[model samples]
Target: MQDKDLPDIVDLVREMGAFGDGGRNRSPGNSNSGYGQGGEPQAKPAPGLPAQSQAAPDLPGHLEGLAARARTYVEAASSPNTRRAYAADWTHFTSWCRRQGLAPLPADPQVVGLYVTALAAGAADNAPGRAAPRSGGRKPHAVSTIERRLSALAWNYSQRGLTLDRKDRHIATVMAGIRNRHASPPRQKEALLPDDLIAMLETLDRGALRGLRDRAMLLIGFAGALRRSEIVGLDCGRDQTEDGRGWIEVLDGGLLVTLRGKTGWREVEIGRGSSDATCPVMALQTWLSLARIAHGPLFRRVTGHGKKVGSDRLNDQEIARLVKRAALAAGVRGDLPEGRRADLFAGHSLRAGLASSAEVEERHVQKQLGHASAEMTRKYQRRRDRFRINLTKAAGL
Candidate 1:
């Protein structure tokens, strides 16, 4: 027969409800609407369509939903820093969800538990070329890090109208298991001895512009318990170095410092000196005069014309390097068995040192350092505890 007169193979198959090669139609019912015929059932529907032939339900967009909910919770937080931290933590959690084939808006409790486990164990389940999950190498996350991540996850989920119930046994079990694990040791505090401070002071030429700036920087940092950012953000118009009678009024007394703080703005007071003096007037006067700073950043870079340039503020990392170089020049040891080099001591050391020195009655060091709790300040206090004990011994106590 001519090809045009021949019946189509597809039509013949549809009419017969079975292929010529003895293929049997396995469908359950003879619906007759593109399905079964005679007493036999039809073939299965195409893969993309719903198995039961029903319309798919629409769901909310994943990232859009997460962002809206995250914004509301973050805005109601106590401080800007907290907002930023929670946002970043949530972002990380969502990224983890994407990696695990889960939706970000409503993460499954089992998946959340797995992510926490991965973070604590320091490795993901899908590592390359491995028969099983492997360790995350030497830098495995600490128990505290894992705990914080879980907390962030829980907080995020709570914001999204979801509750991770204890009935979800995997999450509960993982959290319980982690609680039993020992926490990592606390971090060591940074301290500078009197001689070490003096040595660093002596290293500055004092005859030169940079030397004067360095001297002033160190003295102010020690006297005011100022954070690196606080010191760097100091404006002559806002931060008063001295009162009319020449007494230094550090941290605006009760006024909020608009400069650098964990919460963007912080209320701080000048800490008492080692001699229990309320004012650090002498240190303030000395720095202003030596640095020749009048109306700009108190600490600044020296210019080519031998002038102190106040255009740029010193960054925290620069402050750390400067401290380290000064330490080395002053004959201070940089190497420690377990601790990092002296250069690793950033602006935080100044605040920590002040907290350590201010071991007064009933006044917790955490208050001075602007820490959320005493436990945080204990880390710094422990570093300087030895010096405090030595000073007591020298006093014949």
Candidate 2:
């Protein structure tokens, strides 16, 4: 960084609101916990401290070191999943650009517009036999996804000290036109009703260890309103590591789930169910006791007729697959066409199930979901599966 860019760096850090200490003492560690773990930076570093000097010096060696640390903190500003998604988005954009002989890094706004047009037109590569069984083949990218891709492109350009000029006519007009032309009412995932959940649970093999694990996973996921990532990221012990997302405590009244989500840390209180067969807490206990999981990841891979449980934790995709497999086996959406059935149920169904079926105060439901806004809670809680939206309703249909 040039000496002149130091102030901009300071401003950027200030915007992220991360600086170690009040400048009274230099923190030994430079970790930035974007979650609640990273305590809010309430004030700027006090001037004249040696630590501040380390952060601000312009000498070649010092600048390089500071830049590296800054980069680390910048990357930490977002969740790992989001970073991965952005990286994948960038890769897709670059690959497309390569095919077209266009520069992707310092992307032209015109080219970006063209890319968005291609996406909306479903002009993706037709790789036969490469389609997932459920999705049939590559479909036109959703508007939300295309927009995110644009954002990723813009962010990457900015990181490289270049401007994407998303506001410029070349990009702005095309995106606006696309939105206007393609506007449609939003469609939501089908919420897993309580009965549907029970049916799904029955599909698992209760006699096997894997069945116990799946049963526990489904119950906890529904009760806690956990995201797929949160379900898998949990630890038996407190998730104290920097990467661990959340932890659960078995309490007398219910289980308390303290998780770090996009908004921040929020506590989800899940009470014991009336019946042992359906109780989330009981299922959790049954799974933990059977699996003999005392520490590390709560959910893990079981092998060799469930005799050995691997220490490694299950990934987010596993949760999605598990949900899909159970839902399919149970015929949760039997009325839907076979291929469409696969698209209907996913990890989010558990969360949506709790929101739609639970007879509780809205605030409690909202709190359990860790939603930053009441609107988001209502969106899931509305139960699109059962609720109908029709223009003729107003006409007394």
Candidate 3:
């Protein structure tokens, strides 16, 4: 075709939205007849000139980079458990935002405030086949849970270099007001007494291997103030010995019981390597040696054939179930003066039991329990104190 007959590449590029500099199609020249009417070839546009069309910006790449940086900041600022929790919390927040017709980026403070209110109100329905009410429905959430979600959001925003002002402050104040107004009246934790503990321990019939394992598990759990995950992840060979004189080095000090908490495993000193000092650690060692658990999960599921099968670590729910079963077996049932039913015991009861037993130094109790602060320890101690107070009142104190 003649040069004059050829289509304009510039016009084609513009139509195709290739206007950006360095953004040009790489196709070769036209393959039409070489000879033109005037025998002149068409000149191409200067290489420096941008193609008419511009591809969309690298939005996905930008977002991925942002996510990586945010992850790094979260890792530095908090424990792995906290990071995981915050990630989940933020996911909920973003899901809520999508439902509210807001983009995940550039979260408006007003919208954030509304989200906080919604969270506190528990107005967002997650049930299947039930549409969330636009105005009002469902009971409000506990103040503490709401506050935790808000804190997670604020931390997420701060990590992204966003400013948190009146909206955040308003939410904070609302949470504080809720806290102050209710003051929660100090609810008592359901704990097991010494006799109850013994009953639960003894309920595990020592005739069978699984029975012996369960008994050992309950005893060590109560003795060491172990969280469910910690109990399940206990390394019999490394964490403790046949004599119970080893250490339990968790990942993140004792604040979290996840695998990520093992920041090179911070060891907790127990009994002497070889001595008659009766320590709980020693008890753990004896339990391990007797159990003959050389490797795999400290707690195992019993099979139909009565074989102890090695398995992955048990989750928190399994631990709770174990505790509940043991509680039922022990036949210890009665509501305390606080009105809390005796059936409410779970794995956490073991930790609370240890804390309650430590009636001497509160700080020592907190340390043993791996609580971040004494206030948390005090919360655990409140029920015992209330029981004591009631007894004193009954005695005419």
Candidate 4:
């Protein structure tokens, strides 16, 4: 009806309500977009649906829901050592910044340059909470270490929505200067030779549980080229871990360990040794039987009682300590000062031992070590075929 229908039309519409609206056409752009008119009773919104549009989900609240699943992804993205290093690096930087009365968030590039100058000059050795100046004659970090610390800074800044431009002249120029000023060959950890490993094994008496466990750990770590973390992360079954790295299995020919290292999952085979005394599998089996460990972490702590084993897994550091103990007991590096000798042995010695001693192709060694590249594996091959590729011989000099 037209607007001129006036009071009578309004009275009629008001009295009749919208009963006639079902036959009328609604505008295309209207929210309902229903076939019928304005006030026709709609079907119960396809059952269990609201008549009006429900309030939209909170955008930020939806994001909050992702935090738990996102944390799982974040934790898996980097190794534990990497996370620990990142924290330490950040702490060092922030501590230094506090000593200098500087704002750490929006870091001043000049301050960063000064920080590197201090680090290169061995300022880290001084007493804490004291401002240290750059000095020329002091121990400095390896080039690799300095660069990694810088990366940690950049990463932390990124997490806080701030950009730490490492390419900025402040960082790059100072870093280059530090590299040149403190230039030195990389110092690698000492590798345990096969004879040395044998001697270390002899140090552990086969009669005791701790000795049996250590023997197994040393052999398995060396044979499998496992890192300290991987050594302690093994389980009896596949995918049976909250943070456990991988699993172990016994086969007819050898023992198979599927390990997740820095390079991801890879298999390591430790063939049956000639004798039970040196065999990794046999030693491991002895420990397993004695400790009564089944279907959980391969290595764990034993009580002071020496025979009683705890459910708690061994710490990664314990591997290093065990190596140090074995090395000392075996007198493998007697010529060096006691401190220097102690410093020489660590968990890495096992991995390096396999690399240096294995009479196999570089590729095989690389695979066993879980190194992504042969070049990386070569770094750990201390004193191995050093002059094998003499250019003079190749050139017929």
Q: Candidate 2 — which residues are off by over 4 angstroms?
A: 1-72, 124-139, 239-242, 382-397
TM-score of each: 0.57, 0.75, 0.61, 0.79
User: What lDDT is reached at residue 378 by model 3?
Assistant: 73
Could you give candidate 1's per-residue lDDT for residues 1-397 as a string of tens digits? 1111112223222333222334334232322222232211123331011111221222223434554555445453433334446556765665555455564444468777777777666554344332333443535567777777777666655643357554477788887786678465656535664455667777887667776667666756655566665665565555453211012234533222234456444445554335412234444445567666666565667778756555665664566677777876666664553245553455666666666666474255565566777676666663455654577779898
Best by TM-score: 4
Which residue pairs in candidate 4 collide?
none
lDDT for model 2:
0.72
Instruction: Write model 2 residue lDDT over 29-82, tens digit each, in one string.
Output: 332211111222112321111122133222243345676677567666776677
lDDT of 3 by residue, 1-397 (tens): 1122222223232334333444333322322212222222223221111122223222233345554555445344454456667756766776676566554444356766767666665655444334456565666666666667777766665544355564456555665666775445544446766567778877776666676667656766776677675677665345343312223432322212222122333333232213322234444445456656566456666666655545554455677777888787677664342223445778888888877765678877776666778888777663567655577779888
How far does residue 212 in candidate 3 sit from its true spot (Å)?
2.3
lDDT assessment of candidate 4:
0.74
In candidate 4, position 93 carries an lDDT of 77
Give the whole-model CA lDDT for all candidates, comma-separated: 0.52, 0.72, 0.54, 0.74
Better of 3 and 4 by TM-score: 4
Error of 4 at 21 (Å): 37
Q: Backbone collision count in every prediction?
A: 0, 0, 16, 0
| Candidate 3 Cα lDDT to native | 0.54
State the lDDT of candidate 4 residue by residue for 1-397, as single tens digits: 1111011122222223333333333232232211123223223221111112222222233444454455455556777677668766866776666555554645567777877877886775455454444565356667778888888877655543357777789988999888887778887889998899999999997888888899999999988889999999999888776878889999999899998877777899889899887889998999999989887888989887797888878999999999999999999989988989998999999999999999988999988888888889989999899898899989999
